[model samples]
Target: MIKIPSKRKRGVIISGQGWQRLQQAKRKMEMQGNAGESYTLEELSKITRLSSNTITKVQRRKFPVDKQTLESFFKSFNLTLIDSDYAEAIDAPPPVNRERIVLGGQIPLDSLLYVERPPVESLCYEAIVQPGALIRIKAPKQMGKTSLMARVLQQAREQNIRTVTLSFQLADTQVFLKLDRFLRWLCAIASSQLGLPKRISESWDNIFGSNYNATYYFENYLLREMDSDLVLALDEVDEVFHYPEITADFLGLLRAWHEKSRYGDGGSVLWQKLRIIIVHSTEVCVSLPVNQSPFNVGLSVELPEFTLEQVQDLSERHGLKWKVDEVERLMALVSGNPYLTQLALYHLSNEEITLDELLKTAIAEDGIYGSHLQQQLWRLRRYPELLADLQRVVLSPSPLEVEPIQALKLQSLGVVRVQNQRVSPRCELYARYFKLALAIT
Candidate 1:
């Protein structure tokens, strides 16, 4: 079968030498088939009557090579994973570039180190194609929220739906000064992205409020003209929470548009032509009228931390030949935080540090997380209450009861986890590092 890049690409090496040999054998079977013609992994799996995913794992050589797998390869392709071939496979090394760990910033489509999260990715996909659908994804920093949004937008393009992405973080300080100006700016950008001219301002009337003007522009001009549904994705929507006035009006407007789609009245046509995807952090503390709040509606999704299975898969992608215990030990420290786990594994896979060394110095001044921990320290100083709350959490050996709002604020910082009414450091690393940093006894 053909060799597909292992999906478990994080700080990983081939966890087992025997597994790597199986992968080579699978590749060879495809390459040497039908008088030197090759077959795709899927095609080979079909010929052998094996599950495609099983064939893919074999081709990737992701797990330990065993008698059954080797025998299956022989039956499928009349090939062997033994003798000289086996000897050569055992000696072959993993790709050198696999050690590069992605820590922060947007994870490129090619570099995303996640297993396809189900129901979440799939639900977002379903929402994008539906008429007038809005999807909200909430998660703290480094939790892969934006990465998933990128994928959803990609799916929209594949479906021939038009897409426009706007980031609130990139908006000008002056834009948030007034709702009209902000709405107009939004319209201008959307129009520009849609290859339309700046005609939104030409229709602005003094008699109409900016909110109405913005609605008129989208309904009478932009959305009205588009052949396919236009997907408007707003990332970091919570940035406006600090500007309560703008957030209340702007988000309320979004809620109005969303509600209109369900009206089934004559006005439904324009609203149905537009779909919105909003990304925000649940740590947002804003006061808005419950009746007008958009947060209450739409397909809301919260990203959960990676499970152990996913962490293991990502470790393998990094080319690390980690055993189950090694993976569990790492998780015990990082607790499957995607960025943190990948960081630890990267150091291990590339020989920058050993796993024991990583744990020993994970949050020290000269360690992998020195910069990260320092930033958190600086941020907490600005919010003494949060710093105090976290100090109490780290001081305790077990989860501590914290106010719901306080727990959310802590979780947003990526240092705490909350279940029910209790909160604790997100992982052992956070617990150990912060205990000293905060001087919590």
Candidate 2:
């Protein structure tokens, strides 16, 4: 009788070290020979004389490819393929709920599922070490803004620097009623995070304005108390944007601190010890001079959606051996939205749903994305103007040009995409879901 091999032994995947070596070689080649631009899948396919699917499989290490395919990929990059670089593919283990909580919110620091967006992580890590650096991370909801912020804070901690993270979402409505109350709350929160006493109230002066008092508190107390540099990460800054009364003043105050770090006539040394990380979900709609706006200054990081390759990488990390076509089919509906992709993979990894079943019920109320889509619908219902504008975009046969402010707001909400002042539904799922949700008869 002839012996047959098991399914797990039928193919091979590149090891972690192998993937790193291969990526480094590819990046070096891109820099030296390709004008530093990353080669697209098509460009890579042409160079390797392999199908794009095979290249993706070799690079992503999700689905296994033939040994000859790996050898070809290695040869194209001028590297030799070795046995240690590849391993026999193993069947994925069953999912554990404790480790695979992909419902929503920031991914944990040590989670294998957190896929880096390349230069973005490197940029944030580098920016935080500079004196008085202000790094702004902007993206729509669930685009991993907070997750990135958490990593940045971790990076700061690794450098032996002090770090504090405060989200405006945690602030009470009464806190925004007055600028003084808000500033005091900020200082108090930072103090607590830093293990300092709430001394702001003791030093508070009604005679001086809120901005002045807040600056004085930070410069004199917070900075003086810190042994190393301080990283003040402010998340959900868009909450502050809702209140025009304190938005300009608070942002201007941050700008002032940034400017003081570089151009302070006398206090530059004291202010230099401070670094600010601002994370927001929307564009700054309020008007302010260029010099006074912190949004334009500093290392601005705008988080983008995942690409097809990144989605594949994430799927592999989830222990799902998804093929290129399956990934494309999923992306066709969600278009690489990070949260949606992760949620889909989470369920699939748990063996709860099939891809066919998922696609069919995607827009239904009881689907995996049901609550998420309902949240978006509720948000739109709150703003009639935005609701009407979105309805027009979804109902139209093509992209529509709405009011510029409306376009900005809608794009920020992640409901639509705006390019060259024209707006369209963000994905086919959004279009189909919202068309029914909004009752666009």
Candidate 3:
């Protein structure tokens, strides 16, 4: 017997027990029908007649969905919706709770902490609808690039577009050893993500070469089979920068694809169905011809640091009644860095420490940022040239110039900001911490 809540709201959240029950049912169905493999979002959408974004919302449970949505979701598995399965969504607490807030990685889709950068999100949303759109989002690590990219994909999904995200971070070292192996890995993973069988062995050809074969697989198999336009997001693309051997080739392929869509390559319409979003932290380190580079062509977005007003807005979201002065004080040390600002507010909201104490210990080993500082220190130590250049910038009273590549790499690390070929420490905290850690006089 199931009971419905007397008062129904437009949105509901799944309870833990209900989620577990649904997962079990889904898995059982997968075993019976999908060869023991989990269904992809597209398949699930077809079964439930819900948009993939809606299905994702149900699974993440971070946002609310209509009660009727859950009923349809449950009905697909032949299960009845019960009162225990969900609770009406009420006004939830601000995302200041340490457990609820995602401190690292992409912010959850339902989070209140994500502040829109206005025209940036709007521009991306508009560009993604155009055929063969290439969106390049370049930002230092932890700068909310991934979060923004997620939002773009969410919008596409809501419009019944297919979205696939592939992170280079997931690739193993050996995958980069040969172009063929890397292409095969890429194709196979994409196939699995789309709930398609691994047909790489049959589709790949030694005679045609890896690049062509990879392109063929996508053109004839993946895109042709898809019912909706595909938004393929490749994240952490900087990982490929270290591998110069395949850098030119792989990036050139993307360029060619973009061109194909624009010019009707071979008069095939399939190429137009793909929209690509590439997220990298730094400029390309390897040399690529301007004509062969995807970076040169497309919608480029460079994420700027939060403005003072944005910082104040974020602080308020974290439940801090910070005035302009308090916000400015924090910015003096962090300079509107998004992750740093959010973490600071999270701590302040807990009343764990005063703003004064936080500022004083910010660069200290026992402070909230001690581990983060150490990690940056470790990365610097690995590259003697970067470490040496950063020491110069930190110790000098004025900004210094370093090798262009070194400046880009350091900026990517979020330790320095480069302007007009001059490099300076990103903030007071970075200067103080690295000056001490690097034994600079």
**Rank order (by TM-score, best first):** 2, 3, 1
**How big is the positional error of residue 300 in model 3, measured in Å on the Cα after superposition?**
0.2
Q: Candidate 1 lDDT, tens digit per residue, 307-371?
A: 77677767777787888898898898888787787677777777889889887888889998898
TM-score of 2: 0.81
Best by TM-score: 2
Model 3: per-residue Cα lDDT over 252-371, one tens digit each: 988988888878456447888999999999888778888999998889988889988778767876788888999999999999788888888888888888899999899888898898
Error of 1 at 59 (Å): 15
* lDDT at position 249, candidate 2: 94
Off by over 4 Å in 1: 1-101
lDDT (0 to 1) per candidate: 0.75, 0.86, 0.84
What are the models' TM-scores?
Answer: 0.77, 0.81, 0.80
Ten contiguous residues minimizing lDDT sum, candidate 1: 9-18
Native-vs-model 1 lDDT? 0.75
Compare candidates 1 and 3 on TM-score and give the better one: 3
